[model samples]
Target: MSISTDHTQLQRQLYLLGYSHALPSDGVVLVSTLLKDLQASLDRVKELEASTVRLEREERTTRLGHDKAKGELHALRTENNSLRAEVLGHSREADRLRRESRADQYRLSKVADDLRMANLQLKAESAELSRSLGDCQRRCEARLSELDPRGKIPRMTVNRPFDVSRLQTHKTQVQPAIVDLVDLSSRRISALEHEIEHLEDKLSTSGVELKAAQMEVKERDLELMRMNSEYERMNPAQDVGDSQVPRLTDQVDYLHERAEALEKEAKDQREQFAKEKEDLHRRWVAAENDRVAAGDASWWRQAV
Candidate 1:
């Protein structure tokens, strides 16, 4: 039974026995001490519970932040890979362009060599044609003088022989064609060079960007490692604290159980004491009744 109920029952019993207003000071002190101990235990349990809850909250928040940072790190890694692939592709394109430009330059060089040989051949052919024209011109003039005798036919002023105008015309036409070919080749070479320069610029810029991206990724990786290290540093202490909580709780529970057992033992002892007191009181009353009976018997005998 509860202390208050037990006290009330004890008081009623005492009132029935003509001791209505007295209480045992030792019993009151013992009950008060038990109550104080129980209150202290309850307070300790509340504090432990609050501490456990706060630790759990902090652990959950830390885990969430760590997970979020990991997710962002994953995204950065994916982007870094994509940029790396892009740089690789650009690098390959630049290589291909360089190969094409070299091939074009080789072809242009061969064409220029062929044009030089053709110009030499044209010069040699022109020299042979001029000699043949001079011979033909002398023969024609001798034959015309023999046929005309005196001075009937007029002498030619310019004796270029086999139509110099036609040869000049051929030379003019062929020179312009060769010059146009060279000009076209030069323009093509210039255009290719310009295109190569542009591609090189783009490639260089891509290289720079790729380097910057790599640097950023490296920095992020460093930061991530730092964060991980920091988390590692911090988590062990929290884990140690968390691990200790159960042990502390077990200790608390053991104390509470010990207290409860002690309280039960005290209650049982109190009940046993009350039972013994009642038995003693009954024995004393029985002895007094016997004594009164004996006295009445003697008086009766005397009266008789």
Candidate 2:
């Protein structure tokens, strides 16, 4: 019989307890054909057993491949999550740096403004000092001109005739002190001017530094924006999802559950196939035993 017919017969025998119902119409067949058919059935069983083993191996390989893919995907997701965290951290750091830079710039600008106000105050004080010194010099010159007459021993004008000698002695003593006072005022004015100039130079330097700092801050802001743009492009999904470990862990858990469900389904299929194979094997063994017993009974009857 053909392999297909043998397989059909075996299936029928497994379900119906015997293959007599499916016997061919050739009544002249030898008893050897029955033995040969039994041998073919056994061979088919062996082939089925080999095929089962190959299928089990393939199932195991497929399971292993599934597990490997899951692990790789999990690792990739973990790395992506970590990269997102790193990018967020960098963004926070950039924000902090920007705030600090702004604060420093504000303080520097305030200092520069204060310095400018102080410079204006110094200029006003210097002008006031100059005016006061000029007034003192004029007062001293007027006093000396009233007290002494140049190239004359003493002046006895009609209005100061009685006070000429007293005036000469006082003028000689006070003139020197007035000259000292005028010299001190001049020196003070010079010192004040120098201090104002120094402050102006310092203010100029501070302005230059502030401008450089502002430029640096602008560059940093541009760089930060570029980094943010790139990060957004690289991981737009990360931005859409909540940036938390819990959420990522939940997603991982969901993936693991899906993988486990697939694995469970595969395992269940293997178990069901094994159960069916075992049932078929048992039926084949019982059928073989029944055939052998019938053959023995027939031989014993013939011997008698």
Candidate 3:
């Protein structure tokens, strides 16, 4: 019994020592698995740090782009302001030019009206001058008629002196002859003085008439010039009355030629009638001779 109890105690002691040794080996394996897990977590933290740095750089780039867009917008606004100021200045200049043009047009119209009035006054003066010239010409003609010598003077006649001398020898005839000679000489001197006065009056009248005629001619020339100018302004194709003048002249010439031809035909007809009458008279004479010969033969047979 004492030896069996000692063997059982030795077996319990060996079993307890084996269990302690197995517990220590399990603890070492658990520590090795924990170190491998810690190494994997450190690698993941390094990757996260690199991603944060990239995100910060992208945000700085976006801020620079925004500043550049603002600068360009400010430049465009300044250019638009300069263009608007130039347009306003041009509008003011255009309005000033329009006002000046209207004033010039009004002045030109006034000048034209003044010129028309002046022309009318000149025409009235010219017509008055023409009438005065016509009156002067008529007075001159009356004076010229009085001055002509052929109608005013008379001729003188003389008688023979032999009979007067014979009567003088017979007494009182001598005294009468002397008285008649003195009276004839006095009458001749008075007639000469009257003729000289008449001639002077006629010459003065003729000079006045000539001056009036010259003035009339000048006025007519001016009127013709004015008519010519008006005709040119109107753009006339031909002169007044010119076209019909030639036609009237042609008609006159035709009438003259036709009358000459008719006169020649009448003269020829008269000549032909005279020739026919002469031929009929010769035939009548021959027939009368034949009748007389037949009557003579019968008379002769009765006498035999």
Candidate 4:
């Protein structure tokens, strides 16, 4: 500002001096000195112009940096939006999994009830069959005792059990009625076993799906934690308030707990089913042993 004011003043003084008719005694010397001072002022003006240009260039560089920062901020906002969408998608998936888990639990409960009823029904049937088998064995044993009271080999091997030779063979007759009952009992047992196996397969499949769903929930929870970390890392933008983080954290924690509960329930159901199966199997073995103890297969042992 002082330089501009001095230039203006010099211009006005030079015009006045040129216009005046009365010149000073040392006018030549004064004019020469004034010319040199004007020359120095011109050089200073050139330096100031160069400095202005350099300052303008620095301003442009600063503006460029500002633009880059804005672009990066935009990119961060876009990524944050995408992450939020993913979080919503994961929440929906968790809801779907919860529905499916509940359905599976209901199915398992129903199947367990059906299996219990079936076991009870079959247990009664098994008991009846055991009684019948035991009665048949006892009658056969009585006849055998009448023929060979001391369990010794008879003179006529034709009537003996386990005499496979053509000359000494006895045709062991299984009554058609008894055979039919045995076949029916075998078919019933097989059917029950097949049904139980199928139910178990279904349970296993449900469990696998449930586990996979839980893993997905866990992954989403981890992703949510990572997102929270990202938010902390990016701390500049306050567009998204602090409320979302805690709300989302609560959702993830709830999902985690729910998944664990489902898995535990499934495990418990499986254990109960296994125990029921074991009890049914024990009962069946006991019935078979009773039949055998009543002499169902004793004739062959006596022959041996």
Candidate 5:
């Protein structure tokens, strides 16, 4: 038979045994002995039933707990999968940002290099213009010295006869060359100034871009930090569930031990009861034999 069926049969037998021991007896000692045996048997049966009930309750509770644990595990796994995907996405974004930042840095470095080259070119041009101006001034001084041998041209200007035609020709030729040299120098300076301004503007723009890049990096860092904080909050490695497993395991073990202990106690009580019942049965048999022997003696006397 199945275990449940056997248990049911045992329960029925125990009930029948209890009822049989409760039968009315004529002798007080017999009634008392039967009552005691019935009570003891009932007590043992009650203990066994109680153990069965407790074990059943524990088994039901364990099943419920196992189902709950499985549900929680499934939920955690789903959450872990989502978090892993988020982490991967964040990692990819971080990598992309790093690459962009590197590219920006390279561009900014190139702009700086261009600015440096422009400054160097401006310096060289300015130096060349200065040298040209000095050379032109020296040449003008040499021509003036050659034109006035005694260096008395200014002193004799008021006393000499006025040669307007010769003076006009000299003025026309010399003034144009000097004006041309000054114009050329001015144009060179203007071009250098324009180039310097352009370089300055580029440098300023580069600085702004760098600042923006830095700000972007900071924002990304903050975003990553927020994501990390969220991840930590959502996905705790240790929680109430972690402790609950061991606690539930301990409870199950305790229940098992209690059931085993109850079974052992029931077995010992049954053994003790069996010994007492055997002794009582032996005494009852001896009493019946003695009553029969006495009746037989009495009948024999009557017959004689």
Candidate 6:
């Protein structure tokens, strides 16, 4: 725009100097020089504009790549969160199972103690009953021997009376009572044994379940590790440039800032070019006016 104004001012000066009717060779040369400089400046502007367009395209592409990376990172984060939550749940379940297993162990130990005490009590009672039965058998035999008519066995010197009625009464009543006591002890022992066996089976089953839960938790941990590895591999920035995602993000921002700086530099260059072109236009017009005032100095010298 300044070039055109300068050109108009130059034309008006030529008209005022009475040189418009016959433009001197100096005027023609100056106009041609200005046109050439204008063309060159326009070419430089076109090149700068093309460079800006190219830079813009690259910026867009980089931005898209950054956005895609962010999306993938977000997805990985979401997957990681989900896996972490699942792992936490598994851990909680394992803890609960472990607590239950410990409780079962305590109960099993208590039951075993109870069984031991019962066995000891039963043994004591059995021994006591055996001694009582032996004493009753000996007494009955002595009483029967005394009742025999044969005088082969000599009686004791003590004049104590032999209670035949008591002996007969005890013989019939004590045998059945002892037999029933043994039977009842046997039944109680069997029942206690059965209960212990049942509890042991339950403990075994609990151990199996605990083992299974532990194995499952280990598998989940391995799976989560594998997923983390996969996610790391999928991260393009981490694999290629930086080891960290934040560093990659910062690099992208730097690129964008660099692109903006280039654009700003191009604009400044354009402004500088426009200023230089305006200065040149003003200098050209002054030179032409000076030559005309000097009565076309080059032409006069040529004529000489």
Please state every model's RMSD to the true fold in angstroms.
52.6, 43.7, 46.3, 12.5, 49.3, 44.8
What is the lDDT for 266 in model 2?
67
**What ranges in model 4 sit over 4 Å off?**
1-23, 26-37, 129-304
Clashing pairs in 2: none
Q: Against the hidden reference, what TM-scores do the models get?
A: 0.48, 0.40, 0.30, 0.38, 0.35, 0.45
Candidate 1 residues 134-243, lDDT tens each?
65667778888889888645444554444333555343333445435545766766776777677667667766766776676567556655654554455555654553
Candidate 5 residue runs with Cα over 4 Å from true position = 1-46, 145-304
Over 71-175, each residue of candidate 6 has an lDDT whose tens digit, in order, gives: 665565455445544544444454445444544554555455445545554555455555555666677668877798575354334245332223434433333
Worst 10 residues of 1 by lDDT: 169-178
CA error at residue 20 for candidate 5, angstroms: 14
Tell me the lDDT of model 4 at 237: 65
- How many backbone clashes does every candidate have? 0, 0, 0, 0, 0, 0
Model 5 clashing residue pairs (backbone): none
Best by lDDT: 1
**lDDT for each residue of candidate 2 in 58-157, tens digit (9 for 90 to 100):** 9898777656654554454555445444433443344344434444444454445445544554454445444444555677667777687573333322
lDDT of 4 at 70: 47
Give the lowest summed-lDDT range of ten residues in model 2.
156-165
| Candidate 1 Cα RMSD after full superposition onto the native fold (Å) | 52.6
| Poorly placed runs, candidate 3 (over 4 Å) | 1-60, 132-304
Tens digits of per-residue lDDT for model 4 on 1-304?
Answer: 8655555555557676684444344464565577789889999999999999999998898767656654554454445444544544444454445544544555555455545545564455445554454555677777888887888433332233221122122234334453245356556556655655665665566566556655665665565556555554444467346626554665576567657656865776677678767866876887678667657556774686
State each model's CA lDDT, in order: 0.61, 0.53, 0.46, 0.57, 0.54, 0.58
Measured with C-alpha atoms, the lDDT of residue 2 in candidate 5 is 67
